[model samples]
Target: MEIADMFSTTTIPFSGITLEQVVLAVIIAVIGLIAVKVIASAFTEMLGRTSRLSALIIELLVRFFSILLYVILVLIVLATLGFDVSSVVLGLSAVIGLILGFGLQDTVTNLASGVWVAAFRPLDKGEYVEVNGISGTVTSVGILATELLKPDNTYITIPNSQVWGSAVINSTRMDTRRLEVKVGVAYDSDLTLAIRVATDLMKNDERVLPSPEPVVVVTELADSSVNLSLRAWTKTADLWGAQWDLNREIVNAFADAGIAIPFPQMDVHLDGTH
Candidate 1:
């Protein structure tokens, strides 16, 4: 018998399904699978172009889209095979519910919080942030947890729930940071001359930003000295270095110009009668 003739004559045992229909179903399922893979790859590549999208969000999106595609493909295949879609969906739901009910509450919560973190983006990798009372540089933001690299080079992982629930402070988000240093000069020294000296030093420093202009003013007048406040702005990367360098320059300049930074001292006078 010819192959075509045999396929036409063949019938599934005790059912109306034919050999030809079975072959067609197999072909359709194979094509559907191939289409799903191609679509998934394309979708991922498209997401890669969006620079603002985080890796966590990209992973979540790929999983969601792939699952949706597979579910639709399954339903189409079932309908083509003369099966009731509603019945199959209902049976599948029951199985899924059973799995969900078996202690998946925490997992679901964490997954949801992970989605929230990826969507809102309170902090990004490489940013210096303080969250949940812990300060560190964000190393990675995973679906379940966020990794932080501490100043001491130690890694700390915090669950998505805790990070999302607590307040987040991102210090590195700004382009520039302001730092203030205070120095005390003897009360008798010329305050105007002192301010000019500090201002010149700050302006000459390459790290100091010139737009806002550095400020030097007398903030306090104590018993022995006048407290000078030097407020300057620098790029975030140079903040600490600039502050340290400017402080040393101020002290040296003050000493060269006869400005005395005195320690706390008091004089006592006594009179004796014979």
Candidate 2:
């Protein structure tokens, strides 16, 4: 007999399912899974090539479609096993409703919030952001959660609802940032000279933008020292470096200009009888 006929005629003990049917079902499952993966990947690649959609949106679309494909695949598998597709779908709907009724409200909220996050796009991948009091580099935005990688290599996962509800501070979203460096000099020091030195330090730095013009102003006169505020605008990427360099340069510049940055001190007097 032909292999096809042999498979058709064979049956497993205690079960009416034929070997051919079982083999076909397994093949269908394997092929369905591969098709799902391939289709999802193709969709992702197509979306990735477009500049109109954000990364977050592309990811959400891919995930949503992949899940849909998996559900269809499950239904197909069940049908292959001789189950009624209509009844199965109805049963699944009832089961889902029951699950939601029990306590999946938070899960539903997360999914809705995920959609809002994709639409609004307050933050994007690769951005340094602080959300819900946790600061990190955004790695991805998912259906249920947003993932981040902290500076110390710690991984963080935050719920979508919290991410959407909280204020998101994206440090690298803007092209430039204003850097403020405050230095306190001795009260008796020449305020004019100190201001000039600090202003020049900011202007000399190549990273600082010249359009706004750097400003150094006497902000406060405290008991121990006079506070000078130095404000300069620089590229966001250069903000930290410029601030550090300006701070070090300010100290040396003040010393060279004969300006003094005093330490806190107090004078005590005792009676002669003591």
Candidate 3:
């Protein structure tokens, strides 16, 4: 007998599946799955070998093939079982649709949002940004959630809706930032000396930018102290560093020049009745 005639559904004399036939079908399914695995692996390897290709592109391609491989193998196995799968799935499509609507609506929504984000790129990976109230570096943008690496080394997986809905503040976009520190002096202190020392420190500091020149202005005359505003510019990358260093410089500079950076002191004068 020819091989096709033996396995043909119409020509086969077998009434029902035998132990041998069941074993053979299982073996065929296993081999089919293995073949799919091999093909997908080869495809991924080929894509990976391409020059200067984006990692995301390669990753998406590989994932697609992997998913396709599994699906194809599943269909082949179902076909081997002598069942008409298309008719069955078509009949059940309505029930499947309802199940997906109830159970996966939010998941599907996020996936749509993620696609929008990927296309628009409101946030790129490894960039620092403040989304909503959480400030962190974007670690990964995904279908359902965007992962962020927090300042304290914690990982936050926020949903795509939250990311797209809120305002995003990109702090690292600027090259330099302004540092405003408040200093006060007693009314008796020499105003000229105080301004000289603050401005001198600002000009001399290497981290502080000299373009705008630092403004050492007596901003206000308070009840107890004359408020001096020390406004300086520095590289945005060095903002916190310059802030900590500049305060110490101001104190020492003022003291060395006999200019007292004052503490609030209230004077009470008793009436002559005493």
Candidate 4:
């Protein structure tokens, strides 16, 4: 009795089914898709709030699975219409794969590279990175290309191959970096006093790092003056600030101490009246 009842369907059952059933099935499939989207969003949010790696994996997986689900639902609906789904799918797979392979070869290359990038992490988004002779801040790290924001506020996009092929320089990765400044004083001025002033500037600056310490050397004696090369270490973020401040302090100190900052002094006794 149970088996007979299970197999049974009225000739026109539950509001007399017609093309309306097809429309309703289509609506149900649409509803299923909406539900899939909502669920996927929830899953992503849950994972993102907890573990970043898990969130990334889940995001990628969701994209792949959403397509799979759509295909499965389509196959099930086609089967209900008494179509040969197995043969159809087999034929479609080869044609789809061939078309995709030819058109998306570059995309596949980027996809492979993207996977490696995510795993290895040579550079991260928002870092001030220099590569291939171009210096810029990394705005985005995508599968196909990287987006950089240049110092002049222009956007640049470079292919992933170019980035991975060359040496990547990360400028702001460390806390401290070295600063170099050259000061020239007149040969007539006291060399001892000039050195003392430059050395004192570095010693007094709060921004200057002290472990490796600051250096003041009489690097060269030029025709016009003695060049004093000053090198110091400072926090990376404070580089420009320290440079500006140091220059200002040095200028004021030299003026106060009556030291002469030299320039080219050419003596012409009318070289034989040219």
lDDT (tens digit, per residue) of candidate 4 on 122-153: 66666788989888988766657777999899
lDDT of 1 by residue, 25-117 (tens): 788899999999999999999999865687768866887799899999988877776678999999999987887799767667777887898
**Which of the numbered candidates is closest to the native, going by highest TM-score?**
2
Candidate 4, overall lDDT?
A: 0.76
Question: Over the stretch 1-274, how does candidate 3's per-residue lDDT look in tens digits?
Answer: 5654555534334545544455566898889878877887888788778644444445445665787778667666665666577965675677878877889777777767776666566777777889889999887876678889998999999888788777878666678889988889889999988888888888888988988888888899998889999898888888778878888888888888898766677889989987
Distance from true location, Cα of 232 in model 1, Å:
1.7
Off by over 4 Å in 1: 1-44, 50-56, 59-109, 222-225, 264-274
What's the TM-score of each model vs. the native? 0.63, 0.91, 0.64, 0.65
TM-score comparison, 3 vs 4, better candidate: 4
Error of 4 at 154 (Å): 2.1
Per-residue error for 148 in candidate 4, Å, reads: 2.0
Error of 2 at 9 (Å): 4.7
TM-score of 1: 0.63
Model 2 lDDT per residue over 1-274, tens place = 6998988988888777788878888999999999999999999999999657998999999999999999999888878866689999999899999999998999999999999999899999999999989999999999999999999999999999999999999999999999999989997899898898888888889999997899998889877888889999999999999999998889999999999988887668988996
Which order, best to worst by TM-score?
2, 4, 3, 1
Decide which is better by TM-score, 1 or 2. Answer: 2
CA lDDT scores, all candidates in order: 0.86, 0.92, 0.77, 0.76
Worst 10 residues of 3 by lDDT: 9-18
